[model samples]
Target: MLKTLLVQNYALIDTLEIDFHQGLNIITGETGAGKSIILGALGLILGNRAEATVLKEKSKPCVVEGTFNLAGYSLQDFFVDNDIEYADLTTIRRHINPAGKSRAFVNELPVTLSILKDLVSQIIDIHSQHQNLLLADGKFQLSVLDSFTDNLQQLASYRDSYQKYRSLTSELENIKEKASQAKADLDYLQFQLKQLNEAKLKSGEEIELESLQQQLSHAEEIKSNLQSAFTLLNADESSILIWLKEAVSSLSKISHFFNPAEELQARIESCRVELKDIAHEVEMQNERVLLDPAELEAVTQRLDMILSLQQKHRVSSVDELIEIREKLDVQVNEITNYDQVVSQKEAELEKITKLALKQAQEISDTRKAGSKKFEDSIKALLTQLGMPYADFKVNFEPLGELRPQGIDRVTFLFSANKQMPLNDLSKIASGGELSRLMLSLKSLMVKTKGLPTIILDEIDTGVSGEVADKVGNIISSMAKSMQVINITHLPQIACKGSHHFLVYKDQEKETTETRIRLLTSQERITEIAKMLSGEKISEAAITNAKHLLGSELN
Candidate 1:
């Protein structure tokens, strides 16, 4: 519950502090006494947009600090989740600086306004007089019903499963798409493989065949040239070797007479032996040479075949063709296996989808059952709140597709009179009916959600006397389990408050300021008297106010 609110230079409030208490705390004041200003400042702390005009002294900043006491409420988890420190009492502070900067803190730890709002929302609900759009929301109606029936755990589990299932299904689809594309590529690869394999090719065979073909094509000419060169060197008549042998014989006989002639004869014999050896080697090489036209043609044909295969495959070497064929074979094999894998995955996805649908249907069915009981509970409360002829129902429709909230759409149906048929609650419900319905639903939510504070802004907008007393009584009952702050003008509701604060304006140094003071029992009686009689506080109004206070105390 909200413990203390301190405002400085916020609108008409200049340095005002008000402490709150548990149970129904009512704020009563004159129409323009700045009662709503306090709520507005509180709203700023709740993440509402801050108006820059609230700055103080026309130059200084505005500050609004609120301290909330968590006590035994379940706000500890909220603090833990938000990384906020919390003692037995938690303080939430908000400040608006002169430079149009707004700052907030939770338990003195600086935080954004969104974090403060979320934390505050978990503990308190501020209901203004405007009709609640949440009431018209189909999903919200279903949620309220589920919360009323204690189906939170089941609903949460179901949603978690649904999300997981959706993720897995999406993964399966992506994998299948890639696998299908791979298969198409694989088919193209298989065709290339077949074309490459049909050509019987080998590496380096082209170069070997080309050399053989050139040799065989010129074999006759080469052999004729070798024979002619051999004849000129040794086989011809009057060859140089024959003449040198005779000269060497004559020179050897006269060597004793001349030493230079003896040395020349020896060199001449050495040259004769070398020349004979050379002739024999040449003859052997010439004998080995052979030429055949048929062999040349065969070699040429083999070379042409190898080069043609190379051009057809666009490979510079036969080795590359072999490599390409191997790669294509692997691709074709993968394509053959792809269909089986996809079939397996599809079957598995279908099974998981079925399980997900079953779970969602179960949640939808549970919500419908809860909705009936929820409607009955509210209808009973509405009767006590002076809506005896009202009929309310929770209508459930089964939607086909899956949503984050599940498969059913819920709507609230209502009829305010006995003969009227039920219509959409938002279209047919009046402000009073909406207020009472909101109160009843809030009362039911307290036991489920465990919030400790609920503030109603002008809930009794069109109510008075006995009806206002009933609204007071409902809020008073809620205060037993949680603190309720009612902003009201009705004396009946004001008298029912366990704690009362009166907001009024006063002038200090010719400047108007709003002040809030906690009222004592005697002071409350006087305030209630003013509320009962408006501008005139007659003796009868005082007696009536006293009696009303007395009745409320009893």
Candidate 2:
């Protein structure tokens, strides 16, 4: 429960401190006496937006702090999860600087606004007239139904399965898309592979073919040159070798007459031997260099095929073509195996879908099982609030496919009169009906939600007389289990609080400021009388206020 609230430098409130107790706490003030301002300050602690405009003192920051007693709320896990120290008495504070920057703290440890909002929501619910509009929202309707069912664990399990199912479905879609694209390219891949294999290519075959083509193209010229060289050397008797042999014989005849001639003869003999070997090699080459058109054509055709393949494939060498062939082979193999992969993914998707559907069904069943009791309870409460013929129903529509909230779509159907057919809440319910319905639902929720505090700001907007009295009684009944702070202008409701507070403007100050004070017995009587007679406490109003307070005490 909220133990104390301290607000400073907020709109129209310089510094205000107040304490709240465990039962019904009533706050009554004139219109524009800053009751909403107090709630707005509390909103900052609840992580609502803040601005520099809210600062009454331009230089000082606006501060709103609430101390909560959290001993029996089972909120240790929340503190542990947010990594903050958990004390039985915990303080939550919000500071809004003059520049519009805001910061929040839990138990003096700095925290993000999201963390503060989450923790505060678990402890308190600030229900204003605005929340009555939420009755028509589908998600809110389903959430209310689920809260009544008390199926948090089942809901958590369903969410987990639903997330996995969505993920697997997405993965399966991607795999199918990949397989489709690969199959589209399969024919082209096979054609390229076939052409490469039929080429019978080798790593160095193109170089060898080019060299052979050069020799074959020049065969006739090579043969003619070799024949001429053979004739000059030793092909005829006047050749160099024959002339050298004659010189050697003359030198041998004069060897006994001159030693120089013998040396000259030996040198001419060596020249003759070298010329003979040269002539023999030239004859053999000339014979081997015969022009064959068939062989040349074959070599030329092979070289042309190699060059054509290189240009068609956009490669410079056979080695590059070889690499491409290997890569295509791997792609073809993977394409062949894609069907098996897709089948595996489909099976996995089916498995997860079954699990998700099962969990969703369990959730749906639980909701349906408890929905009758929920409707009966709401109808009973509505009767007490002066709608004796009110009809309420939880209408469930099963969805065709999965959603984040599961397969059930819940809508609250209502009829305020016997002849009025059940219709959606938004179309048929009046403001008074919405107020009473919201209060009834909240009364039901506090029992299951176990919140420590609930602040209702003018929930009696469209109610008065006996209905207002019943609303106060219901609120008082809610306070038996939790703390309820009601801000109202109705004297019937104001007289029912265990403690009463009066909010009024202090005109003594230079600037008008809103202030609150806990009313004593005489003050309560006077305040209730003032509320009854409006700024003039008449004798009849005073007697009536006393009787009302006396009856409440009974």
**Cα-based TM-score, every candidate:** 0.67, 0.74
lDDT tens digits by residue: candidate 1, 1-554? 88888888888877998888988899989889998888888887787787678765658788888788877876677778878877767777788877778888877899987788888877788877763667888777777787787777877877777787787778778877877788767766777777777766666766777777877888888789888777866886677677788889999889998999989998999999998888788788888778788888888886776667678778777788778778777778767877777787777777767776887788877777677778788988889899899999887777787777778787889998898999999999877777788788877987688887888888787777788889888889988988889889999999899889999998765888888999988888889999988778888888888898884532
TM-score of 2: 0.74
Native-structure RMSD, model 1: 9.1
- 1-554 in candidate 2: lDDT tens per residue? 99999999999999999998889999999999999999999999999999999999889999999999998999999989889999999999999999989999999999999999889989999998799989989988888888888977788888998998989889889888988999999999999888888888889888888887887899999988998899889878988888999999999998998999999999888888888998899999899886988999998998788788789889999898888889989998888889998899889889989989998988899999999999999999999999999999999999988887779999999999988899999999999899999999989887888999999998888999899999999999999999999999999999999999888899897998989989998899989989889887898888889987884422
What stretches of model 1 exceed 4 Å from their correct place?
A: 49-59, 112-114, 131-133, 165-356, 551-554
Looking at model 2, residue 331 earns an lDDT score of: 90
Deviation from native of the Cα of residue 101 in model 1, angstroms:
3.9
lDDT of 1: 0.81
Predicted structure 1, TM vs. truth: 0.67
Error of 1 at 533 (Å): 2.0
Looking at candidate 2, what is the lDDT of residue 350?
91
